[model samples]
Target chain A: MSGPAGGGRAGSVLALVGNISARSLRVWQRNRDVYFVTWKTNLVPPLLEPILYLLAFGAGIGALVSEVQYRGEMIGYTTFIAPGLLATQVMFQAFFETTYNTFVRMYYQRTFDSIMTTPLTLEDVMAGELLWGASKGVIGCAVMMVALSAFGLLRYPHALVIIPFSFLAGLLFAGLGLCFTGIVPQIDSFNFPTFLFVMPMFLFSGTFFPLDVLPRWAQVLAEALPLTHVANLMREAALGRLPADLLRDLLYLAVATIPLCVAGIHLMRRRLVK
Target chain B: MSPVIEARALTKRYGGLAAVDGVEFSIRAGECFGFLGPNGAGKTTTVRMIYCASPVTAGDLRVFGIEVGDRPREIKARIGVCQQEDTLDPDFSVRKNLTVFARYFGIPAARAEERSRELLEFMGLWERKDARIRELSGGMKRRLAIARALINDPDLLILDEPTTGLDPQSRHQVWDRVRGLRRQGKTILLTTHYMDEAQTLCDRLVIMDHGKILVEGPPVDLVRSRVGKEVVEVEGYPPGLVQHARQSGWTFESDTGRLFIYTDSGEAVFTVIAHQFPSERCTVRTAGLEDLFLKLTGRELRE
Candidate 1:
């Protein structure tokens, strides 16, 4: 069943991979075109989000907290949470793009169905959507980085790496979001994952403080969340302090992204192709 | 030249129920072929397979002499489908819809722009090229969908219920545009339940029901062979009129207060029926595809 006839489990997986090509870029291009049309509205949120977080959490809370312990030294509380904000922005941008926005395009706009009628296959369409979702994160990161730099929050050349790093983090969250999009029965059903999965990670993923402050079991759970690795890398870059242990976080993100993206494509195929 | 599309024992099953079961047909190049069936008759499912939107459960289906299951991209590249629903990109303007769709077929950007202009003009949508999809009326949207389909210069075009929900004027306009495409000698496949639509557009067609083809032929031929050249419908028909038709070995159908007689000679049938029934109650008209369709599929409402 698994030989040259292209039957059986392994052959089906191979077929799915074969269906994707550079044509997936066409899907990305479509989203880019639509983005440019409403780019002004898209720009407002990313620009304002970091400033609001900086004012509320960074300056307002930092006044009382003063400083926090980092690698082995004390850093300003405002500076500590600044990079965390950037990391969270990557998560929100990529996650929302693939979940609610992608759902609208898939179910409401019927954009995927239109693209599939051409030479493009379902795999190509979903892959393009993943790439576009990642791009949204990268764009949001850039916009927020500029706003953060205005307050002397991010460091120089080391901070430049955060832009590219956001893309990898973007792909991971985008894949996770698409998996949810594929399973949810309706658009309203997304609230379940948004609250249960995303909200929990947003609050407990070491975004606001160090994991050491939490109890042992809570600390272990925080380490398992993908955002913890993302926040760790962002803090390392923002402070211009690249510890050797940061490689562990980088390896974890790389490992998690590939499988999530593959699963994302397969899960979307189940929803779409029949 | 070989046939443009061929299907042998084509089947598509959703779990236990077969949506399209063992359907066999072939479409010659440069001819307008149609699949006429009521709802749930597998017309849409069959067309979806030809366009590679749905997979075949079993047997063989081919387009442009290539198997649909293998290298679907190649077959899909050569065919354009205007689906049953308005699947246009509502986010983009009318002109952007065409140009962006052209890119999916790997058409060069410059050529895509040039084709977008030409197709918009061809579909009489050149003036509203930049208008958003929501702003366009139903007919305009449908025409733009057809224009978008032509952006690739596809060799075969499949229109699934192209004018399903349209006013008479819009339906006529769509038919005119479709006739224009036919004059350009493109191989077209259309599926419609409207019998008049099939008779007006199709060179040859098949009537399908219960996931099977009941009959296939030219509209006029099917009407003449299955029904007849003419029909005499008798309102307030008498009981002896049915008895007279049966004794004369004439093909007829009886309703509550009407008797329809199918015959090659309409005047003769009308005269004979009117002799027993009132002349004012009988009227003769030319037979059509609707008569043949009803005769084959029955008058029962299909869910």
Candidate 2:
């Protein structure tokens, strides 16, 4: 009869979302010491990775090609690689927040199963997971942006747009992370995705080197990637530049976001509800 | 009293295996109904379908007369389930677990807190309310799980193997709480393999084996209707003990090296057993739920 698909259900959904947010906030507040521990164990080490990359790749490789043209503007090799490092940090944080932490809740600890027997539906579970991933991504990416600014690699008007772009980066990877957890056969299956999907995207998504440097066919493959659009968006926003195909890049990311989120929620419902 | 739960030919199949096959029963209001079966006899599966956690492969199921397939949320709102495993969120403290679940049913924070505190005190967990779940023992965790299930003050309470792996002392404590709930006139549907548990707690039960009901009645009537008046259990392999008991006019059923001799005089059979197999361990007891279960479904392990 299509009865009672009323606005009342929407109010209930909002209440569900608020409940999950408050619970997470309380957990974070009570476990403030855990944030410090995670910083020491997970966040601090990766902050050094970009510095090492500059020393090893930028300085070492800059000798052969002192400067490169990206889209239109000319920039030094070290400057080109630095902003890409920030994008990589966002990707990793978003991925880790949903996949690793949520996996423990889903399988090892079974925390979500416990939540499901209550009034919370599968939709609430997915929303909580995605919200946590986005939060972690924002915190991690902000730190990286601050670090880049201190190093003089990031500029003002262009940098103003990076915050929103970082949110998109978080959404993209958070959605992908849920899909990954759903399909992965075992914990060890993550190794193949990291090495194959993550590593290649980090390397070939016009992050380290400009897309024009690649052959025409290789450039086609690069444009097909979700992170390529994200890295391009970051570079354009951070360096005050935009790709000639800006609308296409936005369209590519939007396509990735909608489907990944829908797929993620579907798989999460199957796993958590029953 | 109107029936609180009615399931007709309810079935569930995983892959090609029929886990719950054509299970049918109705639980009356304010009565304790149990599904007594060994492992893999589809107790949990049937419970899952009734709660609408798992979809029924084929059959009709209704809780509080609301059809499950058509209105799951309506049905779930009136039921509380304590699953076999303790699935509490280890990240949250004991108190947070109750309030978090209570909010799922759309309860306000103020009311949820008030009810959470009440339920925690009811379950004797008020002192440890703020402690993380990882810190609690098995028995404490199970009790907390039960408290969490009751947060909504559900009309129908369902438990799957409630006291599965508890010490005798802890089992008794949980049983007392269950009895209290029964006194409060909450309808309970539980599943367990423990015969003593069934005999002690269940007002009526269905003895199940291989996804089918073998018999159903009150605990005392089930024993009297299915088995003999008295029973003697011989522990060791008493060679020729079954034959000797039969020759002495006592009916016998041998199960797992334990011979169950049924007769009007339990002490007479015990005397025969003691005189014939003096070295063997034997006990003379009233025929109870265990004998009825063994008589309906043989002693072979289901799994």
Q: Go through the candidates in order and give the C-alpha RMSD of each one to the true structure.
A: 1.7, 5.1
Q: Compute each candidate's TM-score over C-alphas.
A: 0.97, 0.86
Off by over 4 Å in 1: A1-10, B255-257
Whose lDDT is greatest here? Answer: 1
Give the per-residue lDDT digits (tens) of candidate 1, residues B13-33: 999999999999999988999
- Candidate 1, lDDT over the whole model: 0.90
TM-score of chain B of 2: 0.92
The residue pairs that clash in candidate 2, if any, are none
**What is the total number of backbone clashes in candidate 1?**
0
For candidate 2, give the lDDT of residue B30: 92
* lDDT scores in order: 0.90, 0.78
lDDT tens per residue, model 2, A134-158: 6677777777777677678887877
